[model samples]
Target: MLSRARLIQRLVIFAIFSFLLFVGSQRIPLRSNTVPSAPSAPSPARDSSYERQVQFWKNLHNLLESNSPATDPPERLKKAENVLFDPNANYTRPDLFAISEGDVKQLQQVHQRVVQKIKNDNSSLELVYHRGKRGIVSAAGRKYLPTLVISLRLLRRSGTRFPVEVFIASQEQYDEVVCEQILPTMNAVCIVLSGILGTNVVSRLEPFQLKSFAMLFSSFEQLLWLDASCFPIHDAIEIFQSKPFTHVGLVTWPDFWSSDPSRFFNTIASKPEPPVSERASTDGGQLLISKKTHAKTLLLASYYNYYGETHFYLLLSQSDVGGSDKETYLAAASVLDEPFYAVNEPIRSIGHRNANGHLDSSATVQYSPTEDYKLTNQGINHVKDANAGPIPHAFFLRTSYSKMSPVNLFDPSRNGSEEVSPIRGPDGKPSRAWTAEKETIDSLGGPDVEREYWSHVRWTVCTLEGLQFKDWKDKEGTCQQAKEYFDAVFAPKDRR
Candidate 1:
């Protein structure tokens, strides 16, 4: 009954309204749930690899679950745990470190299963390793990310072309932006442990165990495992072709502290005690290992680490300093009678002298594994006499104090009027972070090395402020201070 013009107007308005609604819905942004898959995870090949990884974890988990003391410690072993073997006092238990015969038998069974599993997976390494066969691996959780970034940036700065894989142990440890976006720019990718192991397996994993597992899970046949704070002073890629890796397939650096593990660990491993000369403990900061050659060694190391909390860690370290996972690798190789090169060069410390005449150490400088290996084979002894060995080629500078993070480096108390470290002496000049002596500086890489190091640290602080960590509390102030310090110490004009 309405007029034709009015009816036409109503239809037009309804049609326009429907069109607007449809277009608006189309333009609406996607929630994270609907967002595209992570950049590193889109490939069908990647999906297939993940599935295989899940199966591998499951298979390994079942084997360990049945045998692990965490689930079922033998009755005698439980009783042995109650009986403390005091190293300081004479104790009658021949099985020292409180390890029982039952413990040994169980460990052996687990070892056999673990060995078989490694053999089974050796062929499938091709599938799991979506990245190249020779890549660097590091474990980085949230706490370690900033230090890791500093290391990674320095790694690339060192002119190394090898790709890297950063392993995060759980979903909790993963940072989506950093992993998916930032790392890829550095030719690195993040591998999530929980994604591969599932909740059941990941639940029981310890922080210390992640390093060995990272090496095992990494696609690379040849790997350099570096700690989050460890930085290479030279090109790391060259080590792969060098004799240290090519000859022995496994190489470890020395630590300041001697390993002095209980004699009972030898009995447990069914191997004789190592010679006094070889008792130097592993640094555990940097390692070069070939999975193709040391697959069993890696697996055994993982086993020792997995049970580290309850047994092997104490047995290996006897509660010694520098004790976490430090001894597992060499011990594993020894137990299997696998050939490996242990660096003979004594680790040296780099630091500034404090007001109290004490050295405020910052890092431990470990010599090049390749150079050390060459010297050792030539019948040179560095540990006994510094002059007897090859001229030390400083390889890794592992920061122990004063990490390269902005929060720590630019801390007001450490660098301001109330400065406490690298103190100003009577001359009223502050000592350099690494060293003050010209000869030591030249030996520890070169005159330009500290410049390179500080430049990297400056870049990390200025660029990564948006990361907004609690440690980097005053991002603006930290960045400003970092730039000023770099300008004063390492800027082009300050170059010596």
Candidate 2:
């Protein structure tokens, strides 16, 4: 026990120590600055593959930088430089860049912390959270929405006695799914990969604006690849057994014919088509690959791309060669000579770049002049198990389209499925049947559906959509969690 004045001094010192301890408990990870890599970092700018994002970022850098920001010009340029100029910049051909509002700061900090933490200790804890501006933890801010409809549809379509996995890749379309709704789905694993990265202090949060297809390869390699655009009309495993087109398939979209394919494409292009690999151009949106083969090539390419090495270790097909993972994919395809199926014409769905093009909505509805899409006796009705024999039932393939019009504010247009091939139903009969898809307005409560979807998806699009995040590997982070979440709520805790 000291005297009064000395006691007061000690009290002040103790208060300072307590304050420092509080600050220590609230320590923010360097990776939370909204850049590439690191948990809880505000997502990324491209849900597209890594190679796609590389070029996307470069072109974006030119376009966005030239156009300049409405707010800050020089500072933005400096920030852009911070994004564009990597001392270890992989000046590899065609790799582009896409920087959203928050990526610059976040990735920078994350990089620093990872290095610092490594230096400070032999072992360290993961730093995946951010002290969000609004005082909400990263996990708490999310008020999950419902993925019931999609989950049920996919389950019915997949024909699984049990739940199945489905990855969700949207252009920031639905936030609740990313933030809330999708979190609860069981059996369906929504790989929330986006291609953009950004920070929004406004929401007292940082949001990612995905811009590329980079992470698609990541998920595909990890066996989390499922085309989100595909509606579950039938068995999903049937589709899976057929050789999965890991990248873009040979299928063509109405938006590609005679148009500059470069617009939305970071697609691999080998003119006259690589001989032996019977294929045409395709969209990365609905592609697939074998976990055993194609995914290996994709992973090899992704690793090289991430390392900034010019030549990738993997080999793809001849015609499927070019862009980021282009050469590697083409070489791989060539080696495999695996025939792939495309969801071409006749059956109709929205998502074509310009729906009214040569393969316009009307034309897709009426007929399919292109060979990529033809009526076939081939279709999938149910997911087959290892022991199940192939059934006579069939289905058709269709191109998915999105209606990007100003009139559809915070809304996406209704997608129609094409009547591709007329397949045989059970009992040795041909079936060209297709379910009537609900009108766009009725799909999920109207135009605001897009908004509702985006509310959760936008930020996720930037970070989770295409990044192939490690946490996403967990069950809770999957589309299947939807069911689990529901079960926990309605079912007994012990059962869950």
Candidate 3:
């Protein structure tokens, strides 16, 4: 009805107003005239629990820093401030720092508080993860990727329906190809340690400390933790349903040595001297724990590992062989007065003979917990005389000498034998690592586990194009050697 210019202006104003209205509708309600909603009734409890968890970690950090500040070097290692072990050499007794009575008392006080809190707090376990999930967990660095790959392949081959979570220490260790491409195919996912614990806390940890932390931060309510080099021979899901595991909700295997704790540790834990029969050091190569049952135990174990380099490692181990984070698990459970079952079976060694006449044990085989439990109840096997009866079935095989990695399996021996590959025995003979394990493997009346292990290793090195293969100097030669060795030692004997 108006003139042309006026009508055009009116239409433009209408269009602008409509466009503005659409944009306004996309945003949240305007802050003005908006009343803030009150938190739900349950929010306060959850918030309190979260705050307590945060404070617990903070307290640990402060205590550790006060006693063994990373910035200050111990007098023993004048040349190296934060480094505990030599870069090129193996960890030795000299690498340990001395702890004082005062240090022990302070640690004890903190631990006492932790115990009391768990006793008082109903929300302790629930804060970690909601109940009703189970999974397997392992930790690996970039260097250990090959071992992890082989271990995981063997795990999947064992037909475990449980999911797997592989924890890496930092962002630097995460491989996009491995994490995103390879692991998901195997029903495993990579969890970066730093992402859950934060960098400040993770920076204080070492390889020995990673395992407990992995178990703590993993989302599973029931956790089966395996070392990167350890693999199960069969499905392990039934362990959760077994009487031993269900009764205590925690199970650990035994190392060969006695595990009498240092006198000081006994005093701190307020535990009596452990009986020789019940004191077999824990072989923590693999373990099962239910967070629903032992949340306090896991938290305390994490604390032990967090302060291990300075205090608990030596306290529990007392310079025993294979001591690192191994003993902390049992120690924590014991401290919490939680019932835990330690398998009543001997840990047996398996390996082919080396150049020397003596047997060079490579991997240690652990027994099935359910079988051990049955034998114990029947009085056929006792912790005091684990070897008195027939060995329980070999459930887990943990590699020590070589971890089925291309570098360790095919490369020149680090012992300065230029021609001797790790996979071979005397005279460069193509031999299985478990040549000495034949008697035990055959006695089980099962398919050759060693052969199955090698087949997986061959598949990993020869077939899979995953990033772990990048460690191989001569991928073709390595893969060929692995295949040839398998064909020679295992293939002809593959009865299955």
Most TM-score-accurate candidate: 1
Q: How close is candidate 3 to the true structure, as a TM-score?
A: 0.77
Q: For model 2, how does the per-residue alpha-carbon lDDT over 229-318 read when each residue is reduced to its tens digit?
A: 222334444443342233333221211211111110122212233222122233332333443333323322232233212122111211
Q: Which lDDT tens digits does candidate 3 get at residues 288-325?
A: 99988888787778777877876677667664433489
Q: Which candidate is the best by lDDT?
A: 3
lDDT per model vs. reference: 0.68, 0.29, 0.68
Ranking 1 against 3 by TM-score, winner = 1
Per-model TM-score, in order, reads: 0.79, 0.32, 0.77
Worst 10 residues of 2 by lDDT: 133-142
Lowest summed-lDDT stretch of 10 residues in model 1?
78-87
Clashing pairs in 3: none
Candidate 2 segments exceeding 4 Å error:
1-178, 189-224, 241-278, 301-332, 335-401, 404-496
| TM-score of candidate 1 to 2 decimals | 0.79
> What's the CA error at residue 19 for candidate 3, in Å?
24
Q: Per-residue lDDT for 1-496 in model 1, tens only?
A: 9999999999999999999999998895543522123212312135555667656666555655665653233222221222222213333322334556676776656656665565566544322454437888888777677778888988888888788888787766666556655677899887776666565566776767667877877778889999999978778877889887898899998876555566656765667876434446678899998876787787778778878766677677654422378789988887777899888777777666665667666677788777777777788866666678456588887876343444656654645533443423334443357664445567776657777777777776766675555444544577777777766655566473
